[model samples]
Target chain A: MTATAVRAPARRAEKPSSSPRRRISKRNFFARLSLALPAAVVVVPLLAIIVVQGIDLVTHAENLTRPGSADKFIGWGNFTRAFSDPDLLGSIRVTLTYVVAGVGLEMIIGVGIALLLNGRIPGKGVIRAVILIPMVLTPVVAGLMWRLLLDPTSGFVNYLLGVVGLGNDHAFLSDPATALPAIIMVEIWQNTPFVVIIVLAGLESLDPSPFEAAELDGARGFGLLKNVTLPMLGPVLAVVLLLRIIDAVKTFALVNTMTQGGPGTSTLTISNYVYRTGFQTFDIGYSTTLGLIVSVALLILIFPTAGRLMGLRIRRSRG
Target chain B: MKRRPAAVAVRSIVVYIFVLWCIAPIIWLVSTSLKSDVDAFSPTPVWFFIPQFENYVNAWVDGGMGQSMLISTAVGCASAILGITAGLPLAYLTTQIWPPESTGSSRATLAILLLTIVPPVLSLTPFYRALFGVGLTGNAFGLTIIHTFYAILLAVLIFRSFLVNFPREIREAALIDGLGEWRALLSTILPNVWGAMAATFVLALIQSWNEFLYALVLTNGDSQTVPVTIAGFLSFFGTNWARLTAAGVIGALPIVIFAIVVRKHMARGLSFGGVK
Candidate 1:
């Protein structure tokens, strides 16, 4: 059942003739277009506001506390200022590290656990239900819970450490050195289940014929997984990796609740920095500018690959 | 192939260990919630304590979590329903009317994907300003609109994935039998796509409920959602760990339970149908 669902898109690709004969008149075409109207009504205005307000804000010096500062137009000033802004650069670095480290670990740990779970295990249903908990837990609660766990004096982690004669008080979130790492650890803990769940589904849907054939030829265990299983699971892995990266880059709640991007800016992700500038400091103009820059950079960095992986058509320039 | 007892033991142990890791924090949260403030903050683990319900009461009533729960549910359901109402037709238009692989379908899907991946920060301030200008900020209405926008994006993608290969002939056949498009959709397609709609609603509801950033920025006081209210507990209670964990439990319990109940659909929806 799951295999059919997983293969539906691939099946659709092979059966273009299935949809070719659906006749439509001009009125029907308009009616079909009108089907998109409600979504468009909500999305279009918001996109317009982002573009218009973005353009207007990026050119000005509009701090909310300063009266009439919205009128101060200095074209590209915020963008130029961002180039030298140490905090912005630092945030960019922190975000990259967070995405790379957090997502990288999640993929590894998640895939390993999924592989384990895919094999026969007792009480599999109960284990699967338990795995769903962390993925669905509220991020704010996850962060706060981790904060309590990592607390210097009273945290469970510290107590655990003390039990093993590792010394109890490490001040994980308060020390700049350990703050980002602690948050990333929580990121992995909370989201690795996402990877396990999806990859387990993919594993379940695999065509077993290859495994049978390989096993008959002496391929087993690690060899079977390395040769047959991983290759078959390539597309699923790519999609999961892509999705994890997309989600991890927007890591705000974990850092916000845990450190508030503090301990001298160690855990300050791009989202937290932008939120601080826009909401806390009320630097509306520069905040918008920072947002536009980060967004454009992110699009350029991720979406081209995303579009391709998700099978969206894009014109390739011919040599 | 022979069954290896040692390897089976190792695998079971490892899997169980991972499960323990996943749920241990939640266990701590619940246990701490039932402890008194001093016991909750004990330098050592409180392995034994009489469970108390006062913190839960405090969080539910005084911390305003009861109010937040109502707001979150309303917003989540409203947005999910609105999203499906808008998104199902567009998904049908793109996948059923147009070929699933056509430029029309790809473009619509791509647009939704773009909206999905674009960081919400790009629109946060602009939305705040726009909604603030129209007197929608600090209330549930603006956040509902924002959540609904995201839900619509989510719904379109999930529904498209499900309906893309759901042979268009069913709808076409219904239409040919003197039924209008709306009636055909109502009588034929909607019935078939209830699974997709359910998945979309569940995931969208989860998304809206757990969303923190916009809820933090857009709403305050009475209109705050669960995350906003629970996070507020941090400062409001100021290291009253018992009350804090209690509020967190109150806020996170419903969706966590809902998610577990629908875990089968979650893998597909969370991946946007990348997996099944």
Candidate 2:
């Protein structure tokens, strides 16, 4: 426009021109172009990859048409098959059980520790950081650490068990019955502080006056906690629970590292199964459908948990 | 009040115990790394040993972590650079592009947030196949792109969080200076956000350095990174404990030291929302 303005002509009777309008237009174009760069570089590839995969899924429908390939799909039929598959069904049951047990244990232990450390605990800051170490430690590292400690041969766990005269050297990770439970235990050990942190936020948000007021009314101890304390904590607790459930449901880290979904399908969470199909079995179509199922399953569990958490928060604040 | 002191002591001891549980394994690995092969595997599980440079030396030279470290570092830097290049402007555009005071259209953030939670593994299947086709399946450059995607999502989140604090006047001033949109962003906005950009970069660096599964599946050769070096310490049949622990210590030490050094920004990055 400015280049054209110079070309257009003999209309300028003013003695001086600042060219403010020209500068502003240049700036707008520059800002828009630069700003668009960041999003373009990142999102374009992702969208491209997803689109390519989508095409692959569609084009390969025949290969996945039940008898043609091991993946067993004819377009949306794969998704329906994934839902009806007994292995997937079993995985859902197993995964839910693991989530409930693992996260439930974490909540109890985390809340207990938080309450214990709620006030004038010695080295509280150090303790708080220490408690968070598990969260920071990679699941692979934790798995390796536990693997060494739990190996029936020279593991520290066996050594400790030997010391206590409960000296049955258990092959924990390889045992079908014990494998999933062992993973749950490891998850509890690692993630309990995640619960503690959230609950600690609830605890931190507390005003001592309410507890004192409750004390004045002959409400004390468990009753005080049940009434004043727990209610105040309901929102945070809801968030914590929802967080734990989401984490637990999607949890593949410790399980993959520890068991690799072994001894049967006993340790096979939806994640591991999908991974097995895609990477280990090299069945893209089957795995995509399986992966899609896992995401849906996660969504199903997550939304209800989120709703419950929000509802619990809302209702607790009503009084 | 007097009884409370005793309670405090008890709690302190408990806290110390838990801390010990957390740190002890890593400590033991480091200690073992410092020892000779005989001392590392003693029935006593040697709690104390004089530090030696052999394990680390072997890890770097003989164990081939030097090469892997280079790959990891290069990949990390590339990812960070790519991520910030893409994320900063996108974040600014999304935040500043729209009319701020509007209703029913604040969903740019919500969309990005959803991407953050979407497991990277979900994309892995496609990435694996796609990379295989493009001959990037086991390439360092390919891994860089994957990390770049992961880092961009996170970097955008970080920048977007800070964008709330940006002086709109700076943008306005750039406009007044006759700078075009791109030039204004490059000359004015990026300079201001450099600190945040560097912070996000460091975080993404650490994340890429520590990442396992993607690297596990992606790279196969001299291209592979640090975590691969660490995992390779474990033999398929297991119980090469001495070498494995040594490798683990070697692989993790630099990152640990780096983390400790940058811990102030590190804390802010992790609990980015807690301050407000």
Candidate 3:
């Protein structure tokens, strides 16, 4: 496996006769110390803060108002409160919808475009460069740019729609019905290129022998794609899908900039909900509880997905 | 096999439509930035008119984006440097120094990767409280530290992956030639990984430049970055579309140019250095 190869260098003790004897030498000690020191300074404090705050909030609900106060203990109170809250529940639903819809649309469109451009096309280089513009633009700027075009009055979107005989009165960001979809559209526009670039890379690296054989056996058009390409592309697609889903779940900047979770909380993702609760409302205990929940949920989801992706990467490299 | 002319025409049309879709919003942004207020708000879109370069002047001067631009650049550079300083060693230690199959090194790598997976928004309040405790709230150095933490994940991953693929014979030859571990890393390994390092640094810089939540939450007043400053335009001038678009254009120009310059590295970096 490529994973084993990646780790093989470390496993091979350099000059075994020298390794054991020299491993603890002054130079080796300093190297290890250098690594340990920074890791400790950064990772230790971060973990300590998360763990301490999480435990403190769960045990002492009174710390909600004044964090680190550590007053009377109320076991499970914050967790129970979070579970019963309608807003938090709504945020979970909203985030799931956004993640599924945003990732789904991106995968479909990204792969389609990647497949189209994968052929011997003209201007492929220029098209790839232009498509990358949205990905590189600041999320805040992207949201603001969309706001300009999506503005109800004197906006290009409405003007163009009116010219085409479609109604121009729709307030894309202001109406609850259209607000979430509008945000999803922005997310797709910016991130779809990410999928394109990644999948295109995967597509390029694929071996041609299988496709050649399939063609000789009369695989054509949809049949070739269905029987030959897609199956071979499975691992790569899985990796892309997982990464996009994880990234999409953390969607905040666009929502914050464009909608502010507005039009009656239609776009309030769990991230925004946690931000509002902890900072705006200053309910530290409940917010920390919610934050812990989000962290745990993501950890569970990411561990398996990341492991599989890494395994696949190792296998691909080895092959 | 020769393709049908009809199919070829259809493919070209699809590619053109996709390219148009990708660039149209950006084109509109640039066009609006150069349009006069009246022209920008015309009932029918202004497809052709004399470009007004004064809007950029107004946005930079009147909008106070000039100061924010300087701050953003400083933070980006500072954080990227710090990220590399801390991340390179950690990555090298995990992948090259320590036994890779060892539980300690693997766990350490996992922990670092996990730090990245956790939503940054969850850490916002905690980081704010911690930084505020040390009087780091609204401080440029504090903002840089926050950005450094963010950049570390990318730096470590890219470095580790690159090192994993690096040829070991050269390192072993150097070690056999009486080179100290530190000397070997600096003299032998570092030069070889320059490509990955440069890519990591640029990616980190762009990320710091584009970061919004921390900048919005952690910095205020003179510490505000361009993204925050551009967002301020919305609240500051409710409907000044010309100036707002101008501000957006000015703010995005540097990164856009940087991205183009490093388009090759970026194509690799976007896939977490896996593709290249």
Best candidate (score: TM-score):
1
Q: Which runs of model 3 end up more than 4 angstroms from their true locations?
A: A1-27, A53-75, B1-5, B99-102
Q: For each of the candidates, give the backbone clash count.
A: 0, 11, 0
**Model 1 spans with C-alpha error above 4 angstroms:** A1-24, A312-319
Docking quality of model 3: it rates as medium
List candidate 2 segments past 4 Å from native: A1-30, A58-73, A107-133, A193-250, A300-319, B1-3, B32-53, B96-105, B165-199, B271-276
Candidate that beats the other on lDDT, 1 or 3, i.e. the better one: 1
- Cα lDDT tens digits, model 3, A44-125, are 7766766765676556654445755557677888888888899988999999999999999999999988887877677888
Candidate DockQ scores, in order? 0.56, 0.31, 0.54
Worst 10 residues of 1 chain A by lDDT: A310-319
Fraction of the reference Cα-Cα interface contacts (below 8 Å) that each candidate reproduces: 0.65, 0.25, 0.46
Which one wins on DockQ? 1
Tell me the tens digit of each residue's lDDT in model 2 across A1-319: 3223213332331211244554454554565666667667667877688667855663354232246663434667667777679888877777888989998988887777777667776576666655655655556666776776677766676767777898747899898888888888888877787676656655875667888778788886579778888887766666667656755676665667677888788898877777777677666676776766566556654654553333343233222
Model 1: how far residue B270 lies from native, Å: 1.5
lDDT of 1 by residue, B1-276 (tens): 356888878999999999999999999999999999999999999899999999999999999999999999999999999999989988888878666666667777888888878998888888888899899999999999999999999999888777766778888788679777667778888988777888899999999999999999999999999999999989878899999999999989999899888777778777777776
Please identify which of the two predictions, 2 or 3, would achieve the higher DockQ against the true structure: 3
lDDT of 1: 0.87
